[model samples]
Target: MSVTKALEGAVGWLTLNRPDKLNSMTRDMVETMAAALKAWRDDAAVRVVVLTGTGRAFCAGADLKAGNGAAAPQPGEKDSLDVIVDFFDTLRNFPKPVIVAVNGLALAGGMEVVLSCDIVLAAESARLGDAHSNFGVFPGGGGAALLPRKVPDNVARYLLFTGDSLTAAEMKTYGLVNEVLPDAELTDRARALAEKLAGKSPLVLARMKRVAANACDKTTADAIRHELLELRDHKRSYDIQEGLRAFAEKRKPEFKGY
Candidate 1:
């Protein structure tokens, strides 16, 4: 399998499994991951998700040597690039939080994956960059578009133009990474963070994600209005009432996720 799926408590773990290839994504890997995300989307048992890879790399990007896993498209059929784009759309729109654990190298399409995710935790040894320029290939993913939104314009330009890698610590300083840990501690720390998120009200978390995403491109006034509308709708949810009741009883809220 090019991708592996596992359930740990309320966290769903999706691992890129082709370490021999630096975990580069193939069309099959993208499809498999999309299917898993769809399955976990509505699964009440799964409240959080973690995406990572095996071996020395998180993902080096698409396998250029394999023609990026492209196959001839039949009439009315989508090709590899379409498949890759759709998978990224699914990931970005996932209701539950998706955390990325960067264990090593993440370049090109791999860096785009990090952009789509909700949070990123990296190992001290991890390195990330846009290597597409080096090979005269333009990024078809979020690398060209979303990179600037995540970091300063200058930083994005540096990565895009130079095709040089940045240390996990350096990326953190640029706001691309949330936390960095020792390589030996990366997996455990990521799992612990996922477990912590799994304890929250799934409904609340989903709403928060939706509202935040919606607000990102809006003006302050529009964003406030949007947030207010969402809050108004959320006031009627069972989770809200349960949370208040639990607070009154001085106990942990047993959120049912509405």
Candidate 2:
């Protein structure tokens, strides 16, 4: 399996299994991940998702030599590019929080995946960059468009133009990475964070995720209005009432994710 999935507690973990190839993504891997996200999106049992890779590299990018190599779709059929785009789209729109554990190198399409995630935890030694310029391959998974939004334009341009990788620490300083830990501690730290998020009300988290994402695309006033609308709707949710009741009772809230 190019991708492996496991459900632990309230977290759904997705690991890229092709270490020998730097866990480079193939069409099948993209499809598998997309399908997994689709399943987890509606699963109340899964309150959070963590994505990582095996071996020395998180992901070097799409496999250039793979069978599906960027070929244009024929007639009605989809191609590698389409599959990759859909995968990232699914990840970006995932209702629950999606965390990325960058264990090592993440370049090109790999970097794009990082951009799509809600939170990112990286190993101290991990490196990230956009390598498409080095090989004349324009990013098909949002590297050019999203990087600037994540970091300063100059920083994004340097990474895209130079195709040079930056240390995890550097990315953290640029605000692209949430935290950087020792290599051996990456997995545990990521799991800990995921578990922390899992303890929250799933319905509240889902609503917050939607509002936050929409805020990114709207003006300040529009975003505030959107948030107000969501809040108005959420006022009637069972989880909100339960939370308030729990607070009044000085006890933990048992959320049903309604």
Candidate 3:
């Protein structure tokens, strides 16, 4: 398998497993990831998700060698590009919090995957960038859109034009990476963060993600209204009452994810 899925407590871990190839994504791998994410979406036991890659590199981008960046045919599936589009859509709207553990190099589509996550924890040795220009190909993996949103417009353009990679520390300065950890500790730190998020109220977490995402595409007034509506809806959740009661009683809250 080019990808692996595992669940630890309330956290779901998805790993790109093609270490020798820097875990470059193949069509089957993307399909596996999409299916795993969909399954976990409704699995109440999974409250958070962590994305990472194995070996020295996270992902070297699209498997150009995989049929010239075109995916081989799969039953009931469109072309590789379509599958990749769906993968990014799923990640964009994924309800649960997702943390990307950039264990090593994350180029082109791999960097896009990192951007799609809610939080990014990168290894000190990690290198990230959109390198499509270097190959004389343009980014078609939502990088053009997502990159600008994550960083300054000019910086995104610079990266796209130069096709230069940035170290984990440089990415952190751009506000893309949440933290840079030693390569040896990247996975552990990412898991710890996921565990911490898993301990929060799942209902609240989902609501926050929806409202925040929705707000991004709305006018300020509309965003405020949407946020208020979501706040009202969240107020009715059982978890809120439990949280308040727990606070008053000086005890830990037991959120039921209602």
TM-scores of the candidates in the order shown: 0.97, 0.96, 0.95
Q: What is candidate 2's local distance difference test score?
A: 0.93
For candidate 2, lDDT tens digit of each residue in 26-52?
A: 888999999999999978899999999
Candidate 1's residue-wise lDDT over 202-233, tens digit each?
99999899989888799999999988988998
- Candidate with more favorable, higher lDDT: 1 or 3: 1
lDDT for each of the candidates? Answer: 0.93, 0.93, 0.90
TM-score-superior candidate, 2 or 3: 2
Which stretches of model 1 miss by more than 4 angstroms?
A: none
Error of 2 at 73 (Å): 5.0
TM-score leader: 1
Evaluate residue 229 in candidate 3 and report its C-alpha lDDT on the 0 to 100 scale. 91
* Better candidate by TM-score, 1 or 2: 1
Could you give candidate 3's per-residue lDDT for residues 133-196 as a string of tens digits? 9988777678888899998889899988899999999999999999999998988898888989
List pairs with backbone clashes in candidate 2.
none
Q: State residue 117's C-alpha deviation in candidate 2, in Å.
A: 0.2
Candidate 2 displacement at residue 31 in angstroms: 0.7
